[model samples]
Target: MPYSDKIERRLHLAALVFLCLIPTFLLFARGAADVSLVLVGLLFLTRSTLRHDWAWARQIDIAVLLLALLMLVVVVAPFGEYPGKNLSRGLIWVRFVVFYAAISRWVLVDKLAIRVVCYATFAALMVGALDGVYQFITGYSLLGGQGMVANGNRLTGPLDRPNIGSYLSKLAFGVMALAFVAREQLGEKRPLAIGAGVMVPVLAVIFLSGERAASVLTLMGLVAVVIGLFISGGRARVLSIFLGAVGVAGIGLLLSSSDRIAGRVAALGAVVSDYADSIYGQLALMGWRFFTQNPLTGIGMGSFEKVCRAQQPPESLQFGCYPHPHNIYAEWLASSGLVGTVPWLAFVGIVIWAGLRLIRAGHTQTVLVALYLATLNASFFPFAATQSAFSNWPAILAWMSIGCAVAALNVFKRSCPTTA
Candidate 1:
């Protein structure tokens, strides 16, 4: 190859490596993940500028601009008191856009890059799963004492919470499923077995972590895959049904083995029955109150704690002030109001529409991306108590998944032009 060709290949390889490491890095070393993302994004921008390949970079999608504008408005809106803090938070959205653009461009142009990412994510998840197992066996993780025990004995590997492990395992399941689909499509046998074997331990760790939301969402995703298999109407449908049965049995066993899991499952009804009395429920009520008070522009991003403190009923005050509403939709309305929420709702609608379009057009490769995004969405649904959507960790993961989905769709279109 010519020197220029060699240089280009090296750049693409470096970018691919960084992209692959992002999910795992976020679990253990979040600062390093951010640094890797920045470095990779800068490399992509620099290379595009040097070679006059500005087509993709210059397009600047309307969704990106709208979100950035909303963040800016949240910072400058009259309700905002901590302008400096809000400004810093707003800038993270810009970084997200840059990261998305860079990854999308790389994955779209190089068909194999997506596979690299899938394999890398699987490898990282394996490491995390192993740590969880080690923690389970010995009451401590191999990586020192980063283990967390929730509700007395529920294992939370390497992180401070069981929910994080549960979340990561679900993501790993998505990647492994993608890998299985890809290998099946390509008529590969060994990789199919490997993917299946990897998933058993991963699922075990998820159940061991004892996060109800993650467990429910994961089962839902599996159901979707089974339905999709039937819809596709192939010989694989019978096998899919068999696997689904096995998965159900495994889940039953998990629930039976763990009292915490069984108790959580049993409490689902009480949770619903007393929704209005729960701390999360009260937070949602307070969020709505804030939204109503400032329906145009919200109390401002990052101001939920202050507003909640002032407006919460004395009984609700006993729950203490939360940084933001746990639900993503409520957070948007409470912080940015309709001005921010309208665009966000539109963006979400478009994503769902696009994913359905691809699935309807028979793009199997896009299914995993769709499943991952769907799980993330379900996690942030109004009734679900979750991390702040605008926070660094969730925001980064959300944008990264979006970028990957866009790239997957683009690749699907290029490979099957008539269908897409």
Candidate 2:
């Protein structure tokens, strides 16, 4: 091979390796994840610039432009309490869109890349599950630390925080998408079987991880996959119903197996019963106050705690100031108000609509696109309490899902040319 060709191949392999390591980064090394994210984007941009191959931007240009517009508004919106902070965070946020484009157009544009990423992600999740379960059973992790968080109610998995369940929830559907794609490759004889096998364990892990938001998101993602299967019209529909039952049974067994996990699940009822007095409710109400106070431009990015601490705390017994309102929509409204919220919503809508269209058009014999969309759905799931959407961890997961959806569409377009 020519020297240039070999260099290109090496760069290409590096992109794949970094892309595959994303899940591991999410699990253990967030800083590395951010670095890898930028590297992938820079690699794509470098290659595109060198070759003058800008075609990939055509599909994503609108979304990227919208993000730029939002960022510009964020930086210049004079009403914000922390203009300097918002300016920096807002500008840096555009990297996520660039990362999305790279994943879809450059890194995962083919079947081989898709398989590599899927298998890598699946393996990572398996490792996480093993680590979390081991800690739950033995009170310590293979990673050499106490594996429980929240007084042993939550499993840390491989991470040092109680976010293992949330982390796993973010990637569960993507791995299931892998299962679907694998089944398609195997002629679909065991499509539901493979999906259910993946599903039951994931569901159990999420439930046992003792994170309510994760549980809700996992169920929601599962529903999305089921819907996609039903639309495809095959034995998948029947098998989906069976899978649901098995999932429920698995959850029941998990709930019965440990009182700590079960009590945590039961606590959801208490939270709901007096939601107005719950911490989540208080935070939501507080966030709404921030939006109402600044109906156009929000207080500012990363200014939630600043603005929050300035006022009296919520009346709930669990009242405490948090970094950001523990909800995606709430955070958006509180941080950027409608000015930033509207465009962000539009981008999300576009992602969902475009992914759905791809699935409906029969681009793939698998439910990969559906599950990728599901991952996004769970990522921003409105009703579920979650971390700030703009924060590093959740933001990376969400944008990664969006990128995976776009990449999955491209893979299916190339691998399965028939459109229904």
Candidate 3:
């Protein structure tokens, strides 16, 4: 290879390695994951500049730019509860955009890179799910240090918290995408068998993790995938049957296992039965109050907790001050006001449009499109309880999925009937 070509190849390989490590980092070493993200983004930019290539920026929609700009604009809001934090957060918000573009524009633009990332992510999830299963059976976790109970019997798996269900649920869609691409490239037969074999354990683990929001959002994602696949008209019936069987079996296992999961389900039922008296209801109401008071700029990123603490909820209702509103919409409204919230909602709409275009354009890429759409539906399902949009760990996962979705759409547009 020419010296310049060799240099570019090395950089691409290194970036792909880091992309694969992101899932593992999110699972265990988050600080390391942050460093890896920066490295990947920088590497991508350096290679593109050296080669005079701007393909990575081509699919970057206006909504992404608008949101990045809004983050900077919000830094100057007079109502910001923490100006220093807001300014710092605003400046670094571009990193996510950069990372996302790198994944779609260059790293995941080809079959080899897509296959590598897909397998790596699948292995990481299986390890985490198996570890969670061990903890559930033994009442101890291998990577989470000491076992602790939250909301009764929720499992933590590898993390130090009970949110592993959310973690698994969020990334499960990415795995589906990865597996589809990888399988297609390998010319694998028995697609339904492969998909069911891979996903049944993941579905079961999420159900057993005892996170109500995670479980609900996961099912919603599955529904989206099924509907998309059905409409695209390829192996939809077999896949749907496999998924239905998996769901019935998973529910039976959950019920027979113990009262551990059962108690959490009953808690969800109680919340639905009397939502106004629930803690989520109180926190959501407080978030609405923040938006109503500062309709234009809101309080600013990372300011929700500081602002929420000062205004106590009704004493008669269950409530606790949280870092961010548990809903993404509420978080945006409270933290960045209408300016931030409107742009985000529009960005989501754009994503949906892009995914639909993929479906309508060709049937060859139906499985990939289905899985990518599933990821988006689950990640941004408006009603699902969520983590802080600005938080490092979850945000990293969300952005990675978004990048993959964009990459898939780009591939569909460029090489749909043949390469896809």
Name the runs in model 1 displaced over 4 angstroms.
Answer: 1-8, 51-54, 57-79, 144-147, 173-193, 310-316, 362-382
Writing each residue's lDDT as its tens digit, candidate 1 over 1-420 gives 887667777888888888787888877877878877887777787777667776764443535445645555553354555566656666655666677778766643453765667767767777777788888878777764755565545666766556555546446544544454455443334544665676676777776666666666666666766676655556657867887798889888977887777887777657678878777787788889888887877777788887666765545575888898777788888877777777677666665565566665664544444454554454444466667877777666666666655555555456567755
Candidate closer to the true structure by lDDT (higher is better), 1 or 3: 3
- Local distance difference test, each candidate: 0.66, 0.73, 0.75
Per-model TM values vs. the true structure? 0.87, 0.88, 0.89
**Per-residue lDDT over 1-420 for candidate 2, one digit per residue giving the tens place of the 0 to 100 score:** 887667666777888899899888888889999898888888877777777777766665446445645654544345688788878777787778778888877887655666677777766777788787788788777874765777778888778788878877777675565445545643343433544555545566687788998887787777776666666666877867776686678767877877887798779988988887888998899899999998788788888887877776544326678888798899888888777887778777776666666655653343566687777777767878887877888788767766675565556556666641
Distance from true position, residue 367, model 2, in Å?
3.4
Each model's number of backbone clashes?
Answer: 0, 0, 0
The 10-residue segment of model 2 with minimum total lDDT is 186-195
Best of the candidates, lDDT: 3
For residues 1-420, write the lDDT of model 3, one tens digit per residue: 699899988999999999999989888998888888989989988998999987656443644654645654654344577778877776676678788778878888777787677777777778788888888778878877546477447888888788788878877786566556555554433432454565766777788888899988887777767666666555776767676676667777877876887888888998878776687776777788999998777788888877766666534335667888788888888877777777677778877777766665566666677778778877787776788878888888888877776775665566545432
Pairs that collide in candidate 3 are none
In angstroms, give how far residue 271 of model 1 lies from its true place.
Answer: 1.8
